[model samples]
Target: MDEFLKWYFSDHPIVAATLGADGYDHTLGDWTADAWHNREREQVRWLERLSAREASTLDDAIDRDLVLSQLRGAIAEAAWPEWRRDPSVYLGTIFTSMYAPFQHRLKPEPELVSAALSRLAEVPGVLAACRANLDPDLAAPLLVKRGLGQARTGRNFLTRTIPSMVEDPDLRARLAEAAEPAARAFDELVTFLETFECGGTWRMGERLYTTLLREREMLGYGAAELHEKGRAAWAELDARMQEVAVQVNGSRDWRAAMEFLMDDHPATLDEMRAEYEAETRRAQAFVREHDLVTFADGEECLVLPSAEYNRPVLSVAHYMAPPPLSSSRQGVFFVPFTPDDFSPDQVRQRLRTNAHAQMPSIAVHEAYPGHHWHLSYIAENPRTVRKVFRTPYFTEGWALYVEKLLQEHGYFDTPATLLAHLDFRMFRAARIIVDTALHCEEMSIEEAESFMSTKSSLSPGTAQGEVNRYCAWPTQAPSYLTGAIEIDRIRESFRGTLKEFHDRIAGSGGLPLGLAEQVALA
Candidate 1:
């Protein structure tokens, strides 16, 4: 399994870089259709080879389950040939490559610039290959919009951010020269995506969606079941929020109260960063003071400005974790800044997401005992499979689970803070409904955005960002709430103290809830 894993990682340069593997540093993954098929074929081979091994032969239970899950996941991914269907894959990669330097802190400044320049030189060829590989007929309109947006961002990165991030005059010259062609290519690609668009549903259909849930996620629930549960959860959240609203004011109205909270926001970018930074320190201190769980030594989080390319899909804050296999453990908690061109009102609107009420819980969600804590713990583990296979169910679910855990443990001492925390819950609950409905073709793009605005506290801009992210990765948006609910359910049933259960969960290698439950219970 170790040899097979090493071969798999080294074969895909992008995956290799992401895992912090040593070799395959100077290359990108093959963008050709032949390479795509070759990867599918390789996954098939891995499945066969892993299946031939007996599960009982593996000494550790987590190891045994991980091997099975990894193989099944590999085979499941190839079942649909989503490489042809998912335009977001290519679109995301374009920007990821562009911002790889700062996002991952992959190398020294000189080495990083040279590597970036090497990659920038190949951007045109890469975009051309992606253009050839993508099927216009399978595209969701939102994807076309998203790809075009990112492509534009990439073009701007070549012209703008690249020149600024590199200080050396020689590097700047190389960057400028390489960026010109890449800039032209990205513009051409964006135009092509815009002009050659085709009409299609983003839904994977019941069959593919079912296989994705059952095979890929190894979950027992289906879209319809999850959707219904989401509605139920939303209703319950609304009911509780109404009582709180009545207590806070005379009326049991959610929107008015939520809007009031949203209006209380940082007035400037510095204020926003300062607020997130302060909340991060507070959350980390609270976790340690309370002994919520073990944190890695020096597992500190830094608040940085979001890359221009990522703000389209990311929310007010997103955590850029260090690669698990790497020795450096610093985590970046990225907060989006208001663009300089925005007027006072626009700036206020952009900064409203980090309102004082929600910043603490959001800080907990992104920094302490959330993504950063989870990844830090996982990095310390010796198992190779743990670093290689990341199930959104466990990683996302754990983070969401901690939100409620802290709330229950008296982290929110004020009505406003508690209300803000519930607001996040309501948002995630609404996301499951929107994600399933949008991907199942039961809801239109406009409807999803409208639903977010009406049903949750999200503004139109944030709502659009949520929907666009959902469009990019079907099933992922729903994972936050679904996984959180599942972990909550497991905790209720598990026979252990809170600390034991949480430690078990944190140490479970980020397995799917179904698998993690057994480990948690044991």
Candidate 2:
């Protein structure tokens, strides 16, 4: 058990350092082809060691649950081509490591500079690892958008973000010298990827896809059943949205009515921030006032603009939890502005996603009673396993579940807000259609984005980015609606207050929804 701590401690030293952990204060771990193969081998051994344990099952359920999550991931890491196909995995690692040391000063000044300098120097090696490891044949061509976007972000981050974080003149000078090579590395990556005459047939097919649902998410049904589930959700949400649109003085066609809400958004960027901040506070206050869910005592949230490192992956808003081991515990809720590099129409569309009517619900989802709230409780225990394992089904599901819960409890408070809330429900429902269809080889990138834009009423560029993510991740897109469906079922099955229901699930340590239901009822 103790070995597990040392083994897991800084496996991804930069990730650990980002979360304020030590032992990685001056290094970016190996990013070579051999290192990744080693990672796969280690995953196998860890799973074997975990399965070999001879404890009573009932007594060790929490540890077992955590291991189960890691076990599924280990299987996929061995089976899947992600380290090769997904450029974000490499790009994210490089860019994130460069700034993560500064994000958390886990050590004193001298160490921080040396750490940052060492990581900055290693950026070229990491990018080289990306080139060496990625098999162009397995790469999803649709993700070229992400690759290109990240290349731009790499240049921008070094020019803008890195300097601000590295305050010391000599350290800043070293980072500047290292910046050119990292930027050149990303540029070379972009040029290399563009040469491929490849297609994005990134399907998991029937059997393994179904196995992912059954084993990883603990679902009773398989891929085909979930397809029907998604289709049904899409139909139901659209109908409900049309019905709600009437209250907003919207046209009978819900799409036309949603346009009204889109136009009802904040006029300028500053106006948008004020609205988001105010609504964030409102959502936090409502959770506390209504006693909707338990908030972690003394946990504070800082509303900030999102980082440039992985923009398209994170999109408009994301939450950063306090390091599981940090003394200063505060979570950051990042709300990003549209990049100036985008075309005017792209900016308009991205801004609409941050529309006034939707901001409060987003506030609820990202901050109070959602990610920040859920994680705050999860952070209370010193359980390293929980920190290591997160199933999208539970994490994203809980966030969406709370969005719906708030609407049902009159948190929307107005017809415009009601329309905005439905907009997101339908958006998630649409991801079900797009995610499976793309991976099932039923749709092209164009077709998938069209489905998303039509279903969610988002702009083309915004929809393109959304579908771009689905191309990289097969089953994750469906987690939003699929997980919410299970939560709704569990909510109806159990006889208890909402707070009691959520607290029980929270206590279960973010189990997959099906297993969570079993534990919650038990």
Candidate 3:
């Protein structure tokens, strides 16, 4: 198992670096077709070897299953032809490879700076491989446009953000020198994408989509059943939101209540950051006072502004988990306040999307007792497989579950705050519908955007941005609600205190819903 893990990390250095694995900081992944084929062959061999081995204990069996699931998922992904169809795959790889070294403080600044330079030197070669692997005819038009946007973002990061992040004159000079060619490489990619003729569709279709849910995600239901489940969830949540709307204001119109809450947001970015930070602290205190779960020692969650390049796509806020293997278990909760570059209307829309009343739920969801809290415990687990093999179903589901748990515990006693929490839940419920519909060819992208806007009360721009994400990442959108439902089922069956149930499920790491139930119930 350890030998297979070492090879897996080495073979996928970008992923390893993202996961905070050492010895991969100076390397980037090979995106060439030959590399893909080689890795696929290697994965097959490892899968066979692991499968043939008998498990010595329950922990061993679980670890073997986790590794086997990852290998199967990777092999299945390789067969999807995404490398040939999506330029964004390569562009995203470049951004993550460059970003991870700087984001995590696992190594010294000098070593990280040197690693960044090494990766910078490889940027041109990676872009060349991207150009060579992608077939214009097989590319989706939306993804091609997205690739161009990402290329521009990458160039901006290389020429601007990277330099600003470095303070030492000598290191800054060296970075600038290496970054020039990388910026030019991004420019070249932008040009290629601009002229790229694409005829492919973004839909994964029912068969492939179903395979992803069943095989990759290890979900029991297929896409069709999941779509129906989404519809049912949306209806239930919509009804609940309507009831909460009446409690918030003297009316049943949820949109009106949400708009009222939006109007009460902070006037400036500095104030917004302060608000989030305060709310995060409040949530943390509440959890501790309630004894919700065991807090990991030395766990710290910092609420800060999102990086400049990430603001355009990040919408409102996101959580950055600490590296599982790192000595520092400090997570970052990034809030993307409205940028000064946006027009007056755009700025208003952005602020409205992240309203004042929503801060508590958002803080609870992304920070304390949500991603940061859950992931901190996972990081402390003795099993490396638990740390390495995570699924959105577990991670996202746990976060969503906590949001409701807090509400039930009277943490969100205020009608407006509870309404905000329900609004977020309704949005996830809507995501299930849109995600299944889009990939199953039941709805068009335009329709999905409209459905999201109407159901979630999201701005057109925000809805479109979200739909694009769903198109690029199939089967992930449904994980939030699906995982929450599964967790609720597990908790219902668990014969323990609420804190014990929370601790047990979270400490088991982010496993598949089935495996999570097994561990939690055991």
**Candidate 3 weakest lDDT stretch, 10 residues:** 307-316
What C-alpha lDDT values do all the predictions have? 0.77, 0.75, 0.85
Candidate 1 runs further than 4 Å off: 56-61, 67-82, 103-106, 167-169, 338-346, 493-497
Q: For candidate 1, list the clashing residue pairs, or say none.
A: none
- List the pairs of residues colliding in candidate 3: none
Q: Residue 40 error for model 2, in Å?
A: 1.8
TM-scores of all candidate predictions against the true structure? 0.93, 0.93, 0.97
C-alpha RMSD in Å of predicted model 2 compared with the true structure: 2.3
Residues 1-522, candidate 1: write the lDDT tens digits: 678777777666667676677765566667788987887788777767766666654336566566667667666656555556555576677666656555667677778777777777677777887778777666567666776666767777788887777778887777777789888998898788778666655666555666667766778978888889899999999999987776555578977887888888887888888989989899888888888887776676888888787765566677777777788678788887744445786567677767888889888898888888888777787777777777887788888889998998899888788888888989999988998888787998899999998999888877878787887777887788888888888888878677777777777678876677777776
**lDDT per residue, candidate 2, 1-522, as tens digits?**
557656665567777666566676567788777877887777778878777776676426666656765667568646766777767777877776666556645466557766666776777787788777777677766665567667667776875587677777876776677677767776787787667545545666667777888877888987778888888988888888878888777455788777777876777666776777888899988888889877666788878777767665656677877776666457778876666576767667777778888898789888878888887777765566665567888888888889989888899988888888878878888888778777777788898888887888777777887887777777888887788778888888888888899887764566777667876777
Q: Sort all candidates by lDDT, best to worst.
A: 3, 1, 2
How many clashing pairs per prediction, in order? 0, 0, 0
Q: Any idea what lDDT model 1 has?
A: 0.77
